[model samples]
Target chain A: MKYFRYKEEKIFRVLMLVSTLFIVLALAIIIFSILYKGLPMLSWEMISQTPKGGFYLGKEGGILNAIIGSFYLSVCSTLLALFVSLPLALFMNIYLKRYKFVLNTVRFFLDLLWGVPSIVYGAFGFIIMIHFGLRASLLAGIITVTLFIIPIMVRAMDEVFKTVPVGLYEASLSLGSTRSETAYRVFLRQCYPGIITAVLLAFGRGIGDAASVLFTTGFTDHIPVSLMQPTATLPLAIFFQLGAPIAEVQERAYAAAAILTFFILIISILARLSSGKFQRNKINF
Target chain B: MMLQNREIRRLRDRLNVSWMIVILAIVLFLPLLLGLGLFVQSGLLLKELSIWNVLFTSQWMPMSGKFGLLSFILSSLMVTVLSLLIACPVCLLTAIHLTQYAKRYVLNIMHPVIDILAGIPSVIYGVWGILAVVPLVSKYIAPLFGVQTSGYTLLAGAIVLAIMIIPFILNILIEVFRSIPTELTEASLALGATRWQTIKFVILRKGFPGIISALGLGISRAFGETIAVLMVVGNVAKIPTGIFQPGYPLPALIANNYGEMMSIPMYQSALMFSALVLFVIVMLFNLASRIAITKFETK
Candidate 1:
């Protein structure tokens, strides 16, 4: 019986090791495949020039339209989300600090919003656009993405705020500062690094999302010059390019994937570095 | 001058209170409003097609006005279930290894890799699936099973989805396992139980609720995943006869056809209806998981 039990334990350990290795293997496979297939097609032209006519059919031109559009969409939406999420997080953490029930309920709703898939947001945005008699455009995409990322931004910042010692807030209050003053002057200053990380996280999410913008951000070959105009984004560009029957167009899709991956990689690394710095500076008391 | 100063302080307090209320209200109600909007817009489709027909009928010929969602619904279910079957065990085992057995240095390397996996965009996964998994499966795995496909099969989507959701499930399970009191494991070991026995009997029982919740979240993710599954699922509007068959899950269906939806009669409504179905299903799973996690935490 003792020997049998020992064997079982060994088997379990081996299985666990294998599972962990499998995850590592999967990640390596995904990254390698993307780099291998996408690197050759990536170039300055792909990054700098808008697509010419019939770009999806393996013709001349580049994905500059998508590159700029994704940046504009993500940056605008992240800033917009920050505008709402910062106030909301502060309101909950500072103003409603004593109301545990209200805080939990608010967090619950935000959690629900966080779980909402981007495609549903896309459909909801589509409905709103139709109701307003609006066409798919950059503004529509921004609104949809802002909604999509607000929950993520708020929740991440809220977690950072929770880590902040209550003594800091009390110290400010004891100095005769108002609640808003304490939030901005004390909590915000302490949590800015974390806040930046959260914004980058949301930016990464916003920029990579394809489903939410599928209907609201109609595809366009040119860079959007106005909020009312439609814009192409990197994910949508990859999707469109991949769908083409031409081999060269498909290769361009891989190139687009590489670009998207590069952006996300930079954001993730930045988030990690900033969070580490934040941790070192974090107050214990 | 004292009275004027006092009045200014009171006005400022009121202004602060109002600002808080306004921001809180918007943040709190926006998701609810979006849910309601999806629900009401989906109702428009009921005017053209009965709910029973849409849910029960399998043929989804939107051109002839038959907007049956059964195939898509089933396809989504099949893909999600298959992926869960593939991912849950690996995720649970990985979480166990990380929380219970792995050394610190090993974890240091593994954690960032998982984070990077989570950070990767779905579109990249799509591109990778197309370039790698599809070809590999079509050329190798399918033939071994005597099934001939172009590699864009239901199984392919499930594999990609399983990969996409492993980190998610692992993260949740790791949190749950970390919360388990170490004394339970120590007690089991002290009672002459082997490590595997202790894990199977004590840790698994304790973390079962959380594991379920994690799987629920994973299912929700798989069901609603768009680009990766879209790229590999072959996008056929049919009830898949086998894992090797091409299928159209609802998200992919909406994504592929929404552009031309207005051109066809009742099509826009049908797509909206599909989105509503997906929204409700995903929301329910999320709510259940949240409730489960909260219950576990409170316990």
Candidate 2:
């Protein structure tokens, strides 16, 4: 009986071990697929050259235009979202909760937006952008992405703002500091690290997003000097280029995808690393 | 210096009230205002409003003027339901396994892996589905069904979405289970219940609401997802005849059709109407989940 129990336990443990290994294998497969398809043609010219009409597996295709457009859109949208979310979060922390029902309703909306599918947002953007007579322009894309980023920023900042002990606010109050003064100078200053994190997260979300960008950010092979013009993003470029019948276009898609993956990976790693550091520093200071 | 600081502080405090109000207004009201403004600006009500038929009809052809959201809505439901079916049970079991069965060392090792899974981009999951899963499905599963296949089916998309969302559900379940006072489990055992029975009666009950919320969120997440579905579901506009047949969901439809319909009012509104529909459904699901969490916490 004892021997049977031991053997049964061993089998179960092995099964669990194998399942965990499968998870690693799955992740490795994705990373390896991109690298295998992309790396052979990942030369300096491929990275630096301008976009061309005809596809080339070994030459001429570069993400320079896509990268510039993607970076511009992501940065602008993240900043816009931060600008929108920070004040609202600060307001919620400062004044809204005096009426609990109203505050809860506000939170309810924020949470709703947080879970909204990017596709639906894309639809909303389509309706409005078309109405504005904008045809897949960069401005349309940025504004669409801007709204998507806002809820994420607001939620993160709200939590960060809530953590600044009410006592701190009280102390500021007792010291004859006004609420606005304390909020802007003291509270905002204290939550600076978290706010920066919120911005980075928003940027990461914007840059990594493909669906929201598909319709609004009109795909152009050429880079735009103006935000009003349509431009291709890395994700959109990957989708359009890969979906083609041409093998060269497919190879370029893989390369663009690898680059996009690398950017997201870097951002994820940085966020994790910095948050860890912030936690340690918080304990110390 | 203290007097100067106090004066500045007083001035700042006086300035803050209106600023805070403005912030509140923007956060809570911006989307609603924008949506309403856009709706009015677009002249949706005065224009040819065929949204009702578009939403309910079976066919969606923008080029030919025949549009419907039936398949899109149904596909969205099917994908979400299938994903929840796979994800909910596995997540619940995984949570139980990690929280109750596994040793602390084993759990510590496993936790990071789950977190890493949660962190991976959905697009990466789609890529894996295209490369690894589709081939396997076509090679094995589709052959059984007597279908020639690429494996870019609804089943594959649902499975990938389920796998992507499982960690989220598991994480929430684990938190809920861990928070259950250990004494309740001990009491159940002390009262002569078996380990499984104790888990069923006590732990499961304790975690039920959290699990429900997790499932609701998972369903909502799966429902709204676009890129993964677009890539793997094959983007056929018709009602899917089989699991392997191409289908459209609201998100995929919007993504695929929105850009191409630059000049048409009906095309634009159909997409917006779809968006409005999806938004309302997601909002309801979110609200229910939040209420469930609050009710559970209060209990």
Candidate 3:
């Protein structure tokens, strides 16, 4: 019996090790397979110019249209989400700090919103577009994405707000500052790094999301001339290019995907680095 | 002058409060708005087909206005359940080991790795699915089973989804395991339990609710995921009879029918109805798991 128990223990331990190794191996394989297949074709021109004539046939022109469109879309959405969520976060943590029921209920709702899939947002955006007699354009995409990221940003900022010592709020209020002033100046001052991190994180999320914008942002080979015009995005660029029959187009699709991944990778690394770098600057209170 | 200054401050605070209320109201009501919008749009279909009819029928001929969704519903459930089956044990065991047994340095490295994995876009996961999993299914897994497939089988999708969701499920499990106070494990160990036995009896016993919550959230996430699954899952509108067969999930159906869905009558409404179904399902999964989470937190 002793030997059997020991054997069982050893076996399970091996199983755990193998499972963990499988995850690590899976990430490594995914990164390597994609990078190797696509990295060779990556170039400055590949990101610098819009698709020229017969672009899907693997002709001249880059994914510049997608790159710029994604930039505009995510940037606009992230900033919009920040403005919308900042007050919500501040209201919850600073203004209504003592109301546990209200706080919990709001947090729970936000969590629900966070769990909502992006595709539903796209569907809802479509409904709105139909109602407003609008077309799939950058404006529609940004509106949808802003709505999508608001919960995420609020939840992230709420986390930072919670970390704040109540003493800071108390001290600020005791100094004759209004609640709004304290909420804005004191919490904002302390949580700015975290707020910035959340914004960038949401931006990365918005940039990479294909499903939410799949319908709202109409496809175009040319760079968007206006928010009203249908615009290309990197995720959709990859989707459209990969769908083409030619191997060259498929290769560029891989390249576009690689570029998108590289953008996210840089963002995450920056998030990690900034969180650490900013830790020293944060006032402990 | 002091009274005037105080009065101005109070007025400013009042203005800020009202301004905030407007924004907060939007956040609070947005989900309801979305649900209402989707329902109203899908109401176009409900006007023609009963909800029960939509749920039960599987014909789905858009040309003739047949909008049966039974097959899509089943495929979504099948794929989500299968991916959960593939991902849960691995995530649970790995998280258990990392939190309970692994050295600290290993964890420091692993956390960021998990985050990066989670951060990879679903579209890229789709691309990788095409590059790696598709071929593997066709060449190796299918041959072993003596079946021929285009490599875009239900198994291919489940495999890709399992990998895509590993970090999501794993991250939550890690937090769950870590939150279980270490004293319980030490107490079990003092009673002459082996480390594995202690984990089995004490940690698992304590963390079971959390584990359920994590899996529930993971299911919700995997259930509604598009792009990746759509890219690989050979979007045939049929129930997959075998793991190697092609299937179309609801998210794939919603995503694929976008833009060009106008030429056919009831097609847009059908897709919108699927989104409504998806929204309600994801919401329920979230609601159930959140209750479990609250229970675990109280415990």
* TM-scores, one per candidate: 0.96, 0.88, 0.97
- DockQ numbers for every candidate? 0.73, 0.43, 0.80
Q: Which should have the higher DockQ, number 1 or number 2?
A: 1
CAPRI verdict on model 2?
acceptable
lDDT of 2 at A176: 63
- Cα lDDT tens digits for candidate 3, A61-164: 89999999999999989988888899889999977788888888889999999999999999998888878998999999999999888888899889988999
Q: What is the lDDT of candidate 2?
A: 0.74
Worst-scoring 10-residue span by lDDT in model 1 chain B: B8-17
Model 1: lDDT to the true structure: 0.89
Candidate 3: Cα lDDT at B297: 85
Give lDDT: candidate 1, residue A209: 94
TM-score of structure candidate 3: 0.97
- Predicted candidate 2 versus true structure: per-residue lDDT over A50-150, tens digit per residue: 68655444336687888888998998999888777877788788776477778877887788778877766666676568668887888999989998888
List, residue by residue over B1-299, the lDDT tens digit for candidate 2. Answer: 98898777677666666665776666577557545644553355226546567667888777786767898898888888877897776676667667777778878666656755665656656666776677777899888988888788888878778777777777777878887889999999899766666777899888888888878887778888877677787777777766777667788777777655657866666566666777767767877997887677667
lDDT on C-alpha atoms for all candidate structures = 0.89, 0.74, 0.90
In order of DockQ, best first, we have 3, 1, 2
TM-score, second chain, candidate 1: 0.94
**Candidate 2 stretches greater than 4 Å from native:** A1-25, A56-59, A94-99, A130-135, A164-172, A184-193, A278-285, B1-7, B14-17, B30-52, B101-116, B144-146, B189-197
Model 3: per-residue Cα lDDT at residue A251: 95
Best by lDDT: 3
User: Model 1 chain A: which ten-residue window has the lowest total lDDT?
Assistant: A276-285
